[model samples]
Target: MPPPASSQSCAPAPAPAYRGRFAPSPTGDLHPGSLMAALGSWLLARGAGGEWLVRIEDLDPPREVPGAADRQLAALRAFGLHPDGPVVRQSERGDLYRRALDRLLADGHAFECHCSRADLAATGGIHRRCVATTRRPRPAVRLRVAPDARVAFEDLVRGPQVQDVGATVGDFVLLRADGYWAYQLAVVVDDAAQGITDVVRGADLLDSTGRQILLQRALGLPVTRHAHLPLVTGADGRKLSKSESARPVDPTDPLPALRRAWAALGQDPAALAGADRVTDLLPAARTAFRPQLIGRGDTAS
Candidate 1:
């Protein structure tokens, strides 16, 4: 593995350099919504001629089904989304995560807390309470956010935005009460660890981007280009979820889904009518992968 990002790592990490990855948590079968994200992220990295990696976000194995990650990979293969590097599994990197967490805790960037869902709700969501109350460690680790500090970053798709992460997201958790690695800490370390210079994912993760940026800043790691695509909601106007029993993506027939996703993104799938297979569709997308070409309105799955 390459060396982890340190004080000597490049500032802002040069564009069209380093790598990008699609880290999917295998809670269930891949769905249309999931495929859109994979396609978008894959195209983003490929268009840049950079390395593309795949990672199974299986840190929370309790939530992971027995064969879900492999099944997800099978779907990606069927859809022709191949990675340039070996796939990484979060479950296999526990030591790395533990080291990162310990560093954050020792540096005063994180602390131990026993706040439960109800304990946090009682204080209007962990805001202002962390400053006044000192709770003993029962099971979780919470990051320390300066109450007045603001985290600002630019989005390639959504443009410039600013958030007082400390106030808005509150002092977030790094390790959950159940001992699972929190998405915030895991993703931050993983991005730097993976040498990702660009992060292209669904827009629903926009809020989390600020927190990731904060963690990067704290660690002195380089910031990457962040682009959050328009969310793919369901017909019911809700986020399409595997838990809600969203229709499983048919890996055998990725064509229909690809066409539908293009339409959903407001792109003209018929523009390349002769595209009959995965290889043909990918080339078409790479040639026509203009972010501005994506329609401006919201679309539900």
Candidate 2:
């Protein structure tokens, strides 16, 4: 005999509040490209009357510059882009990631992977399954993306987006071979823990969204809204990255860079014409910001 069905219908859960975040790697000082993303995220959060949080992605110690995280936070404050709560650091949250990884492994949503770069070179670097004949003592952990798995979501800034995760990314990493948590796993766990309702960052990370979404589903976490701002490029038409020695923005004088970033977002230049300080400029910019007006293509810095 089966139990009687409950009278309540299985409706979807209510959406969370408008909580947004700006997460930056502590690789170097805040540069034009990074500042643009920070400002864009701050404006969107302020415009929507939401809380804006900051997180330092310092999981990769080898790549991180000493004191870069503190400098980044200082620069953001100079630009009047203050976070609503205490800043979260990925380095301090390893246990959360470990628990999530354990759950995925227990549920068969993830597996231990022994394959290295050379092993999957023939497959164009996409890991479908374990290809190594010999397993290392410390193998990496990867999510088991099914062959037919597809993720679709509406990007707040880029509009409707879809990605075939299995075919394109195939069994992405959750933990690296060096015993470090991968960005996909750390970000998914932190976002859910922080109750992030929106993720607004540079378009350079747009491709990683699908993997994060899949991880969220596997972990039974809420998927946040995404808005990827256009990437800031250099004269060579390449993305401005901290690793390439992109010029860092001066915190002492932030108006020029702020205005330039505002223009890059396709917002009206006149909107910030009379503003002389960061405080005055940020409110005006927030009031004038229109997400629909942001361009899809990368902008020259």
Q: Using lDDT, give the best candidate's number.
A: 2
Best candidate, TM-score-wise? 2
Q: Give the whole-model CA lDDT for all candidates, comma-separated.
A: 0.76, 0.87
The clash number for model 1 is 1
lDDT of candidate 2 over 18-49, digit per residue (tens): 88899999988899989889988888888888
* Clash pairs (backbone) in predicted model 2: none
The Cα error of candidate 2 at residue 86, in Å, is 0.2
TM-score of 1: 0.89
Give the Å error, residue 135, model 2.
Answer: 1.3
